[model samples]
Target: MGGYDGLVVLVGVALLLTTGRCDTSCGGTDGSPGVAGTPGRDGRAGMKGEKGEPAVKAEGPVDEVVLLTLKGEMGNRGLQGVMGPKGYRGDLGATGRPGQPGRPGPDGKNIGHGQQSAQQGHSAFSAIRTDNSLPRYEQRVTYQTIVVNKPGDFDKNTGYFTCRVPGVYYFSFHSMSKVSMCLRIASDALNEKLGFCDYNRNNDQVLSGGVVLQLTARQKVWLESFRDQQPSTDQRDTRDKYIIFNGFLLFSNDPELHFSLCGTGRGGFYFPVCSVRLPIMLHHFVLVIGALLSFAVPVKVAMESCPAAAMPGIPGMPGLPGRDGRDGEKGQKGDPGAAWAGGLGPQKGEKGEPGLMGFPGKRGQSGEPGRSGEPGLSGPPGEAGEPGTVGTQDRAAFSVARGTNEYPEKASVIRFTKVITNINNDYNTETGRFRCRVPGTYYFVFHASLEDRLCVVLKLDQTLLTSFCDHRRGRRQVTSGGLAVHLSQDQEVWLETKDYIGMRGKPTGFSIFSGFLLHPH
Candidate 1:
C-alpha cells in the first residue's frame, strides 16, 4: 500500500511538528473546500510509531492557521433537544376527547302553517268609497287593502266587489284626506293604486262608506277606483276635474239605521260621484261565525291571499343581545373513566347505587297472632227484658225501673195533691203510680195507707218475689203469682219505689190500686 501510505504521511508530519496543533484537521489542504476530513490527534498518534520509517511523502508546509469560520449561522438553537425523547409517549394524550357527540339532527319538519286575513266584512263595494267603521261593518279584503285598524281613519278607503250573490252586505268609505282620491290595494288582483288626489276642501268633506250586513256564499272579489288621479302636484282641486261616479252604495252598520247625509255643489264641473255596494253583516256574518273558536283557526279566511308580499315582523329582533363572559374552572372530575389505573384500558367501574327508601319497609310481622279463643257455655235463665220507654219524665217522680221506664207523662207537670202533700213539693203530686199492666202476678197496692197496719208490697222490678212471694203473710192482701213468671217481650214488673218504708206497722201501701192486679194467686 505504497509503503503504507508513505508511512502514514511521515507520522502526520511528525505529529504536527510535535504537537503545535494547527487548528486540527491536518489532512486535505489546498486552501479550503469542505467534505475532506479525519486526521488529527497528531495524525492518529504518530501512525503508531512509524511502522517502517522509510516512508516520507509529505513535502513542505506543516503549520496551519485559518480560523475565522463562516458557515450559514443556523446553530445554537439547542436546549430544544431534550424534548425528542418524549415522543414515544404520545398515544396517551388522545384524551383531549369529547368530540363524539355530533350525530342527532334530522327531526325538524313539524312545518305547520296556516294564515288567513280578510279582517272584517264588506271589504269593498263602491260609490266613490266610504268606510263607516262599524255597527256591523267589517271590511275583510284579503283581495285588496282597506283595514286602517280603527274607526280613526275609517276603513282607509274601502272598496271592492266581485262576488255574484250570497246576500246581506253593506260597506263604505268616503275618504277625503288632503285628497288625491286615494285607494291603493292588492292581495292578488284588481292591481290598482297607481295614485292621484284632489278633494277640494271647504269642510263639506262628504265621503261615507259602510253598511256590511248579510253576505253568504261569497264570490272571490274585484274592483278598483284606486280613486287616484290628481298627480300634478295635487293639493286638491289643482284644476278640478268632474265627477265620474255616483251610482255606488254599500253598507252594513245599521245600528238601527237612521243615518243620512246630503251634498250639492257644481260651479264648473260634472256630476255623479255617489256609490255603494257592500255586505257581510247578518251580525257581521254572525261575527264571522261567532269568531269561529275552537281555539280559533278561522285565520280570517286563510291565505292564498294576504300575500301582497307578506312582510311584517321577524328579522332578528332589531337590537339588544350580548353579555356573557367569566366562567372558567369547574372541570376536574372527568379522568376516572378509562378504567383509571394509569389510563386507557377499561375494567373497573361498578360500585354505587343503593339509595331509594324515603320510607316503606317496617310492617312485616303483625299478621300472625290470631288463634286463642274457645271455651264458654252455661247460660239459660234470662227473661225479664222490656220496659224501656214511657219516659216523659218520671225517673223518680213516681218510680219505674226494670229495663227502665216510668212515664207518668205530662212531661214536667205533676201538680196533683191530696194527702197533706208537700215533700219535694215543687208542688204536690200523687196520681199514685202503681202501674202494673198485665204480665200477671202483681199487687204493688197502696190502699191510701194509714189504715190499721196493712200489707205492703212494693215492686219496680225485684219482682218482689219476696223470696218467691208471700211477702211474709202481711196484714193481708200480698199477692204474687210467683214462679209462673216469664217476662221478656218487653217485660216489666213494677211498683212504687223510694219513700217506700213499709216494715213496722206496715201502713205503707200508698194506694193506686186501680193500676195493679194479680190475685189469681
Candidate 2:
C-alpha cells in the first residue's frame, strides 16, 4: 500500500511539473496527402488495470500550517445542500431597568366655584299678607300676598313656597285677630298640617306657631286659617307687625354637612343659634341646664378633690408586734323568724305532670351561598362502553338573514330569505320563525346593522325576551343581543323590529340571526 501510494504521489508531481506544447491542425486544400492520411486504422485498446489498495490512516494530528495550506487549496464550490432543521429557542433576555418619572403637568381650572353656586341656590324664603285693608272676612284664607320673600322660593300668586333644595328648615307665622280663630300652616307635599296656633279673645290677640321641618325638593307649604273658625277682620293698619310668615334654611341634606360663616354665625355663635328663630321650650331649657351641669359638676368635683403639694415626712422605723387578744364566748342562736315577716312566702305545691312536646317551628330562610371550594383530585377514568350503532343526525340549528336592508316602518316581525344553516328544517325562511325541535336549553342571538335608529327584540312566541337598539348619526352601526332559554319542543321564536326606519341593508352579510340547541332533554 505504501509503495503504491508513493508511486501515485510521484506521478501527480510529474504531471504538475510538465507542460504540454500547443498543436495546430492544417486544412487539406490539396487532395493527395489528405486522402492518404484518412485511410489509417484505429489503435488497439489497453488491458484492464487492478484495483488500488486502500490508504492508511494517520496516527497523529496534522500540523497547523499544513492543515491551513490544504484548506486554502480547496476545489470549486459544490451545489448547496438541503437546509438543516431549526435549532431550539434561546433563553429570554433579562428585563431592562425602569425609566425615570416624568414632570408634572400644569394646574387645572378650579371647579369649586360651580359647587359654591349649586350650594348658594339652596336657600329659604319668607312671606306675609300685604293687603290687610280688604273688608272681606272669610275663614280658610290662603295668604295670597308677599311681604318678605327671600330667595324667591315662595310665590305670592300661588301662596306656596316650593322647596328648591332638600334640607331642614324653620318656618314661623304670626297673626292678630279680634275674634277667636285657628291659624294653621300646612304642606300639600307632606299631605298634612304642620303646625297650629289659636287666639281666643274678644280683644285683638296675637297667634303664632313655628315648625322645624325636613322637606325635599319641589315640596310646597302654605299658611291657612281653619274654615270652622272665623278670623277678625280688623282693618286697623297698625305697625304691630302682627301678621308675618318667615322661614330659613337650617341645613342641607348633603352627606357631609357644610357650614358657611353666615349660616353658622347668623345669631352670633359657632354652633347653630336656634334661639334666634325657634322658640326655646321648657324641655330645651332643661336640656341646656343639664348639659351645663354635666360639665360644671365634674370640674367642681375635680377641683375640690385635687391634692395639695406638701413636703414628705421622715421615714418611720418598724414597730414591735402586739400581743394577741383573748377568744370571746359564742352567742346564743336567735329566735326563729315569723313566716312571711318581710313578705308573703308561698307554700310548696304538688308536682305537676309533664306537658306534651310542642310542634317544631318553620325553617328559617337559607343564607347566602358560600364560595365554591377548590376542585378535588381527578379519579381514574371509567372503562370504555360497548360500541353502539350510529344514530341519525338530528341537530336543531338555524342561521337566517333579513331579505331587505330597509328598516321596518313600524314594529313588526322581520322575515328572512337567506338561510345559511338550517339543520332539521325547523326555521321558516318566509316568515323568519324558528320552532324548537328538541326540548332542551338553547342559545339564540340576533345582530342588526342600523343606519339611523333601530330597535330589535328577540321574542319567544309572543313574549319579548330581549331587545337591542341603536341610533347611528353618520354611518351604519351594528348591534347584537343574545339570550339562553330553556325551550320545549314546538316552542316558536322570532325577531321583531321596533320603530326602525331608514336602516341600510347589510349587503356584506352583517345582520344575522342564529340559534342552536345546547343539549336535548
* lDDT for each residue of candidate 1 in 27-61, tens digit (9 for 90 to 100): 33233233433333321221222222221223422
lDDT of 2: 0.55
The list of candidate 1 runs beyond 4 A from truth reads: 1-165, 180-198, 201-204, 209-216, 221-223, 226-231, 235-521
- Candidate 1 steric clashes: 68
- Highest TM-score: which candidate? 2
Instruction: List TM-score per model, in order.
Output: 0.13, 0.26
Model 1 score (lDDT): 0.28
lDDT of 2 at 41: 40
